[model samples]
Target: MKVLITGGAGFIGSHLAIRLLKEGMHPVLIDHLSEELPHARKEYQLKQVFKTGPAAYYNCSFLEREKVSAIMEKEKPHAVVHLGGLAGVIPSLKDPSAYIKTNIDGTNNVLACAAEQNVKHVIFASSSSVYGEQAGVPLSEDMATGRVLSPYAASKAGAEALCHSYRHMYGFQMNILRFFTVYGPWGRPDMAFATFIRKLFHNEPITIYGQGTGRDYTYIDDIVSGILLTLKSKESDVYNLGSGRPVLMSEVVDEIKHHFPNVKLLQKEARIGDVTSTWADVSKARVKLGYDPAVSFKKGFEETVAWAKEHSDLI
Candidate 1:
């Protein structure tokens, strides 16, 4: 099988590429590399993941509809995993038009191309941000997406709805994976985990928003595992990818303090678009996709800390 991963060079995309390779599938990755990521520059983890398999690279933006279509035509991938988009919530707040253009329009372009080519399956990466600041606890897939806190979340929700429409109209298999607060080594720098690690290592005061919002910090490996399962299942579905346990921001800070014993923190008001807590009810994923989070928060955090220490200069 041949698969096209839109954000192949990215954190989750790179990991997913490797997993597909190990399963004897050829991976074709398209990434704009729009953001300057110091750690991801050399593709260190990406190289390791694809070190032993057949892989192809394309430096292209998803917004370029013609280019995306051309690549789909040339690759003729069996499955399409669309993961590329404007990823940061804060950035989306600052530049909403860009977020909408990329996240929503870019997704439409991918789905349209994949539908045109009759791709067998498409696994899209949605966010838990779609839940917004609901009064409900343990967010389930059935809950209606509420007032989007930011353009980023709105784009994701819009893209998800677009995907459903394509799935229905084109009869294409689609898996809309709603990811919780994913964190671990090879994570995005824009995320709090990476930012905290970098700031603490540099002796810079780390900012604590909402005095530490809680999240279900799903590890990268666990997320990759769930993704691969979805790919192989060859079924269209939506499942939450999370650890099923919410870890508080204060707990994360406390863990850092325990490890470093010298880190400084600067408390601040919780910014807009930031949710107070994110807890996933993984019952559906467990039953439908056999999704099981293998790494606990403690283990995952330790691994992240170790990676941060090794890549201190890069971070």
Candidate 2:
């Protein structure tokens, strides 16, 4: 089978690409390489990523409708893992228009092209942010999405609705995977885990927003497992892919403090668009997709710290 991953060079995208290769499926990846990452240059990373992998690469934006369509027509992939979009709530606040254009419009173009080409399945990367400011534990997929706290979350919600409509009209599988706070090696610098690691290593003061703002921090490998499962299932449904363990920001910081005994700390308000806590009710994923996350918070954090040290030059 051939698959197209939109953000193939990204943390999850790159990892997924390698996994698909191992599965003997042809994986085509297209990414804008927009983020200003701290570690290595995007070009360098892409070179190292695809050096020996049999995956194909296209350096472009998801908003490029014609190019995207051309790729779909050429690749004729069995599935398209649509993970390309501007991520992060705070960054979305800084440039909401970009998020609106990329997440919503980009998804529209990709699905339209895939539908035109009769792609068998499409696994979209939605976000837990769609839950908004709801006061609840174990956030479920069926819960009503309240006032979206950020443009980024709103775009994901919009994309989810769009996928539903397409699934109905086009008669193809569309799996909306709502992801929690995923972190691991090659994770984005904007993410709390990476930022905290970099700052602490540099002896810079680390900022903890709402100190207790917890997240269902999923591991990278586990998420890739879920994506591969969804690709095979061809189920038109929404599933939450999370660790099912909500770890607090304070606890995460404390763990880092263990690594760096003198790590400085600073507390601040959990800025707007930041949810107080995110906990996923993975019963549905467990029963349906057989999505069992194996990596624990302690193990994942340890691995992340080790990765940070090895890639310290980037940090």
Candidate 3:
């Protein structure tokens, strides 16, 4: 079957596209190559995984309704994996308007295009940030999104609602994945793992926010596996893509020090829009999607360290 993956040149997008291709599915990628990220990563994904020529790449913004609609109509893909958005919490605070427009509006455009084009299914890449520093431990999918502290979280929540509305009215299947702290090889440079790895490599001090806040750091492989299984199930549902095991920021720092040995620490007050902790209760994903994360934080971190060392030139 043919699939359309928005943000297909990105970290999770590139890896997910690779996974679909390996399963003999053709993925048409729509991404804005705005020179925002390192060109090396873009070249690697475009050349390595998509080199076989079964893939199509469109360097267009998803917020442009006419452009997205035209592409969606032409492709008429069996499924649309909507992974495009204005990422990062801190940046969302700086430019809430841009985040709202790109994420919420862009998501609306994708849903509208999918509904109009009659795509079989639309899968959204939501975020655990929507939980918004919940008082409860092991946040569940059923929990109400009560006070979104950041514009980024609000946009993701809005996107989820839009997808649900389309599913309810149009009978289109929509799967929303609330991915938690995804990290590993080919991960985004903005994330903690990549930033920390870069600092370690440069012998620069790594910053720790919220005095070692805890997080459920899910690996890329496990998150991708959950997405693939959810696609096969073909059900309109929400699932938590996370390791279910939380790691404190201090613990992460300690682990990094073990690897780098000379890595210095620069403690800082928690930045605004930062969450103190995040833990996911994956019971729903386990039962409905048959999802089970196979990687441990320790193992995943070790592997990521190795990747950082090998790809030092790129990092």
State each model's CA lDDT, in order. 0.86, 0.86, 0.86
Worst 10 residues of 3 by lDDT: 45-54
- Candidate 3 residue-wise lDDT, 1-315, digit = tens: 888999888888888888888888888999887565787887776776666557888988888889988998998898999988778999889889988888888898899999889999999999998898774499999874657789999899888888888899899888999999999987788888999999888888888876647999999999999989988886788899899888887778778878989988878898888888899999899999889999988889999999888888776
TM-score of 2: 0.96
Q: Which stretches of candidate 2 lie over 4 Å from their true place?
A: 35-41
Give residue 24's lDDT in candidate 1 (0 to 100): 85
> What's the true lDDT of residue 80 in model 1?
95
- TM-score list, all predictions: 0.95, 0.96, 0.96
Q: Write the residue-wise lDDT of candidate 2 on 48-103 in tens digits.
A: 55764778899888788889889888988999999888888998988889888889
Candidate 2 backbone collisions, by pair: 39-314
Q: Write down the TM-score for model 1.
A: 0.95
Q: Which model scores highest in lDDT? A: 3
Sort order, lDDT high to low: 3, 1, 2
RMSD of 2: 1.6
